[model samples]
Target: MTLGTSTSPLHYYDVSSVDGFNLQVSMVPVGGGVGCGVTGCETDLNICSPSTFE
Candidate 1:
């Protein structure tokens, strides 16, 4: 399984407020169990702080 999270550009600078947006994600599954021949897959995910922008 894979996982990830989206980031906002407004986070770079100190802004008063902003509108609304969605954190969209897309993935394409491979055929069969053909992978890197490893036991399992390695995840490269980004963990974002929930209360950072709030």
Candidate 2:
């Protein structure tokens, strides 16, 4: 899991499968935020990227 910060109007991410074979990705925005300032941000983004050899 990794956290990324961007102020750009548009953001793009490239998620590739193992060894750039599958190129699949799972993305979603964070929830609640509660007291934190981050009310809208991609959270728990999982990219089960794996190498084809593996």
Candidate 3:
């Protein structure tokens, strides 16, 4: 689903169940946006993000 708004397009991610016990999530920018550290902008998550931006 679209993580952010259509106008902003901050992030896009997919979600699914893993082993019927846990959740699996993967995210990337809608177009071409900066990641975790980008001067005035930054990204945060309760768990973790991939090593690479993807």
Candidate 4:
């Protein structure tokens, strides 16, 4: 998603696999301000065993 003016603005974004989980995804904001940092799923959910959900 986008925030602020188009000329000079801030941006917020992340990778999502809501419908389905394929490859691992992550997001790291460089030189970010407060509350801005890395976010994502580093795990390989595709190969996870059913027991893992328990």
lDDT of each: 0.32, 0.40, 0.41, 0.69
Candidate 2 at residue 42, lDDT?
A: 36
| Alpha-carbon deviation at 39 in model 1, angstroms | 24
Return the TM-score for each candidate structure. 0.18, 0.23, 0.22, 0.46
Q: Quote the lDDT for 32 in model 1.
A: 32
lDDT by residue for model 1 (1-54), tens: 532337532211121223322233333444534432223213322234255554
Runs in model 4 lying further than 4 Å from the true structure: 1-3, 6-10, 18-20, 43-54
lDDT computed for candidate 3:
0.41
- Report the alpha-carbon TM-score of model 1 versus the true structure: 0.18
Ranking by TM-score: 4, 2, 3, 1
Tens digits of lDDT, candidate 4, 1-54: 456587877677756666557566777777778888778887877677365442
List, residue by residue over 1-54, the lDDT tens digit for candidate 2.
334457543434444443534343455545624432322223332444244344
Which ten-residue region of model 3 has the weakest summed lDDT?
37-46
Task: Spell out the clash pairs found in candidate 2.
Answer: 17-23, 18-50, 18-51, 18-52, 19-51
Of candidates 2 and 1, the better by TM-score = 2
Question: Which is the better candidate, 2 or 3, if ranked by lDDT?
Answer: 3
